[model samples]
Target: MAVARRRHREPHFVDVALRHRFLRHAHRDVQRRRIPLPIRHPGGPQVKLLYDWLTKEQGKDVVVTREPGGAPIAERIRHILLDPQNKGMDPKTEALLYAAGRAQHVSDTVRPALERDAVVICDRYIDSSLAYQGLARGLGEDDVLHLNEWATDELLPDLVILLHLEAERGLERLEGDPDRMESEDVSFHRKVGEAYVHLAREYPSRFAVVDASGTKEQVHTQVRAAVLPFLAPDRVET
Candidate 1:
């Protein structure tokens, strides 16, 4: 389910989603801010606290949603992708599944909310595929990118906040048994990290790289600072 707030003008803002080394925790909201919130990849801590903080700060009606599983059909697909029991899944198949889930996710959740002029804060989006399947899984970034772009009707985030952390450190931070993605060898994660860095460099205007090594409060502060300029009091749509 998603949290939504109503507005008059057509929704025209970016979304937020984080790609934890394994757990993809993200959200998407639309407002005059017009910029997607920050994101963190694996090794980076969960951004649930940040999501809660944003929900409160954004006020009562803001919509919060996640990718690959925001809607029922998409969620089912998420399970198939993340379930460790489904070992030895083909890399291309994994990428295709992600695209399929995203298609349903957009159709059922994201587009509707955006049409209602709601702020949509999502957990994960295209970047996860770009890193995991594109680079790490050797599927090729362009192909995955094109696939997802088509899947979501070419919708793209105005800003992507990346919570940067070392792959090894992110793995160390895990508390419980890792999921299928998390269980992958360190080399795979390192590739993910590298891909994120490359993406940040490639899309400097749209990517905000935040250091996740700091305390929670400190990290939140950084996230707020990065987001504030976009959602300045004067610019927010009512």
Candidate 2:
């Protein structure tokens, strides 16, 4: 019988939890889905509260960090890469810069945490590159992927929750002027969307796509559902 099914991936600067936070109540585990809007919307306070509640319920089992900015050196690099004034930056140069920042971040932050057996969850990771530079910039997914592999010693995410949103809709959710990537042409954004969709299918094992258009609670419900099973905590009732 024929049926329907779906999947997903990530974007943005990297920031996850400690590597062992989920089971040991200390570390991080990456989530596939993201709902930034709910965290900013007028009613988004509920989502933030839910997150605080859940994290508290889980105890001090996670460490939230972002790459390219988590470490001081890398943060400087992040500024250079994302500054709208740097739009003239070559695509390959941009990709390489991200990888460089990641390399420093991993060497200084990620690897050390994992060595301590901590679950490290990062906000954006390799998948972001595959979507932005790989697909959107026409830089070949395999190429961007290979670049990151070297950057992180092939450290793959345990999970990648994609907050699936159309480019236009995603843009509308923003309050400030668009950043370098966000400021790209509509067609460019459309390509980014396509790239994400493609990535979901290409990497289903760790990727789970969730709708970003739902209400804060609705969206949080899905993200919580996806992450709870992994944490196997005394599940927060909310």
Candidate 3:
């Protein structure tokens, strides 16, 4: 049964029926779908945390994880990559390391969950590398995309939600000493933002742009609206 949110015109008969069907068999009807929130903005972690809570409220039977550290092997790679001490890391090396972690994550964590018919909600994925290294670090977009293809065997998220805000505002939201990527200059992050926007435009079907400057609740509302249409097969007029 198809489902849609009730609106001012009142729930359609199909909507009512689908909701009834869902309520009657909520535990059994959950389908496997990948939902990745690309934390492109500095304020995005808060949005991601809030959305995990929102997941429970939605009863979508989704499992949440983060890139570079979702699985055991990937976590080790994460430590190496995120270590601030690794300041001298080369761009090509950084791209390869990210792919290595992602490959492990897909094989050991993400793919398995999806096979089990569970929705896997990830905090970040290939796009992060594409924005950080491919565009910002001059690693070449095609090369980065090819690297990721080898890593995940061309696996793509069902939906990519980009939390977008201006670079300076996002930087202001940071706390303490910044990490390697975070420590980059404002112009670097501005380029990263442009890269993200480019990806959104380049892949509109898979990308949803959400304003990240709003309060947590406001952002979450937009997040839900962006994904709900994809989640429910029913025709959503809005």
Clashes of each: 28, 32, 0
Q: Candidate 2 residues 107-215, lDDT tens each? A: 7876676555444556677788888899999999989988997787656565566777777887788768777877788899889888878987876655667787887
lDDT of 3 by residue, 15-53 (tens): 112111112111123222233444547544554554465
lDDT of 1 by residue, 19-106 (tens): 1111111233321223143456541234565565556755423455676688999999989988888889999899999999998988
* Candidate 2 displacement at residue 91 in angstroms: 0.6
In Å, residue 76's CA in model 3 sits off its true spot by 1.4
What TM-score should be assigned to candidate 3?
0.78
lDDT of 1 at 21: 12
Which portions of model 3 miss their true places by more than 4 Å?
1-37, 43-55, 233-238
lDDT of 3: 0.67
Name the lDDT of candidate 1.
0.67
* Residue 167 lDDT, candidate 1, scale 0-100: 94
Ranking by lDDT: 3, 1, 2
Off by over 4 Å in 2: 1-54, 233-238
lDDT of 1 at 187: 90
